[model samples]
Target: MRKKRALAGSGAALALGLAAGYPCLWRHACLTWGATAVEVHREMPGDALLPTAPLVTTRAVTVGAGPAEIWPWLVQMGPGRGGAYTYDWIENLMGLDMHSADRILPEFQDLGLGDTMRLGRNGPVMEVAGLDSGHALVFRSQDGAWVWSFGLYPSRHGTRLVSRNRIQPPDPSPLYRLFSLYVMEPGSLVMERRMLLGIKQRAEEPIAGR
Candidate 1:
């Protein structure tokens, strides 16, 4: 029975490795949620709006690659493509459909100052207010509640990636405030950690355009 259990565990690990990509590290690196404040719960898209909060958590990761390499992964992020790379399994378990990156097609047409860069099946749905190629990009919902930014910098080893999300305090509601502090903030921390690791693995890999 013990031997059978060990084999089962090994089979599960192998399956995960295949799902992530060719190399094992790509998936393994993302599984570890470092120093997270709260355990994560998965939910489908349109499940429910995030509980309103006063402030959002921000996190950073240093990758062993260049900014050029990391930028593609960020700008082309979505449900199918690279994904937010935050809490993927949680998103999947929640019945939210997981997406693949191969469907991405980013063309540099009509890119202008203050013009929101748009892509994916839904055009301009996700907007980044502050965008600078190879440096930083900020994503915010116009008139919506959540805002996030991705920053990159040259590092001794490669580059540094920073992700920040801002949660606006909701209308007068005590329950909303409480959920933000106890649930959302902690989940954000966990997701941010995973996001960085995912980028790191992809950026460091020996791929074209990196």
Candidate 2:
């Protein structure tokens, strides 16, 4: 009975993510896309082989301003809020895209955990968590599909922002590891860089410093 229940649960989980049109199943729906193929890698120094960590990747960007300057951009990111720093041309070309980074609270002070950030046409909503004022913010989705965070620190020039994502396969499918290393990691790299760039541009522009 226990085994049967577990199997049933797994099936339901998979079914839930496999939305129409997209062959791929989303652990947390970001936006519907075609089947994406990714490659996974597990490596460590010489003799010490660190067990494969849950396909995590990190991307970094430098801002000309301070963390306080950069905080608002991240907090404001959402579909209807702040448009994602990503390229508008490319995103629009992709078709039926949603989820802009700018979508967020009107007031920065209101930003906090449990806030639901939505995307286009019922795309997955990332729940805010692990928020540290002007320091860090983490957004997570159900099924452990996405664990994205931003960490800000002082730099000699100005401020450095690092965005990290840790993704876990919703199911024990072989494709999970591959996608983490290849597709998701690369996508994260591209998106995070654009995000930081957008933050930097906005922060450096005119805005009352906090």
Best by TM-score: 2
The C-alpha stretches of model 2 lying farther than 4 A from their native spots are 1-53, 89-109, 175-182, 207-210
Compared with the true structure, all predictions reach lDDT values of: 0.57, 0.59
**70-182 in candidate 1: lDDT tens per residue?**
78777767554456666667867654444434323475222333444333344334455666777767665555576666667676867767665555665559888666545
Where is the poorest 10-residue window by lDDT in model 1? Answer: 38-47
- For model 1, the local distance difference test gives 0.57
- Highest lDDT among the candidates is held by which one? 2
Per-residue alpha-carbon lDDT of candidate 2 for residues 1-210, written as tens digits (9 for 90 to 100) = 999999999998876554332234333222211111221122211112112335555556567788877887787766555666777555555542534543234654477778876554545567886788888888776444666777777879788676656655665777775555446644655565666677777777754343
Residue 25 in candidate 2, Cα distance off native in Å = 29
RMSD of each: 11.5, 14.0
Extract clashing residue pairs from model 1. 80-99, 80-100, 81-101
Give the residue spans of candidate 1 off by over 4 A: 1-53, 93-96, 100-125, 207-210
